[model samples]
Target chain A: MNGISAEQLNQAHQADLAIQSEEGVVFEHAWADPDEGVIYCLSDAPSAEAVMRIHQRAGHPADEIHAVPLEV
Target chain B: MNGISAEQLNQAHQADLAIQSEEGVVFEHAWADPDEGVIYCLSDAPSAEAVMRIHQRAGHPADEIHAVPLEV
Candidate 1:
């Protein structure tokens, strides 16, 4: 799939918001293989905007920021 | 940070074996926000042990599996 389904995207967005609210800045992130069509991320900042800035500075902006719940 | 400092978890396990050798069965994944730690993922299942058996049947079993690189 070239793009994720709307429902999936919504879930991802919600997760992102949750993370942003908690973390503040996100500095790392990634997306799935096109064939598989998914997304993920990690960050070191305190805000989502900061994370986005990092991506922009790195010359690779993110398409989405997914909230990853850790087992640890 | 609760964890995630050993060279950023070895570049997130080398991007999770390069997305499990190009998407082999990763249902979905995420990690981070632990005081700005880092990790992320997304999948639809093709390999990686069927995305680790869908996280051991969705019971939450994933210490790490991050290789998210997407800009589209």
Candidate 2:
């Protein structure tokens, strides 16, 4: 999603929440760079695919995902 | 940054912290998707430019930044 507005992101986020349970996904937070048209979402899921599926059903299919097994 | 490793992100985070105070920036958390060549960092700063300055000084210049005035 390039140059997406906060309103649009909020709508997509709501959709994700509506169906995330089916995929055992819990979206925790999301960050959007409307000027850059970049979005970063954090979620708790069994796998990246699960996260992808939720977004897809939510009408904002993720371009890609990465596993973050470690953090500071 | 593309295909950036977790280690790399951590190092960058450290660098950000080292000089963030100079720019009134505090980086809280960071997520890296090595497979997708993406990284997401959360920070509290005076402005998007302040955030960019910190990252730039840390050697990982942000491609763009967006204000998240609202969240769920």
Q: Compared with the true structure, what per-residue lDDT tens digits does model 1 show for residues B4-72? A: 554554455445545453435643443454455544445655455666655545444566543333432
Model 1, position A12: C-alpha lDDT score: 53
Off by over 4 Å in 2: A1-8, A35-37, B1-8
Q: How much is the lDDT of residue B68 in candidate 2?
A: 65
State how far residue A11 of model 2 sits from its true place (Å). Answer: 3.6
The 10-residue segment with the lowest total lDDT in model 2 chain B: B63-72
C-alpha lDDT score of every prediction, in listed order:
0.49, 0.81
Interface DockQ of candidate 2: 0.41
lDDT of 2 by residue, A1-72 (tens): 667777888888899999999999999988776665668788999999999988887788888677765565
Lowest lDDT sum, 10 consecutive residues, model 2 chain A, at: A63-72
For model 2, the local distance difference test gives 0.81
Separate DockQ for every predicted complex: 0.18, 0.41
- Candidate 2 lDDT tens digits, B1-72: 666766778888899999999989889988776665667778888999999988887788887577765454
* Candidate 2 local Cα displacement, residue B52, angstroms: 2.1
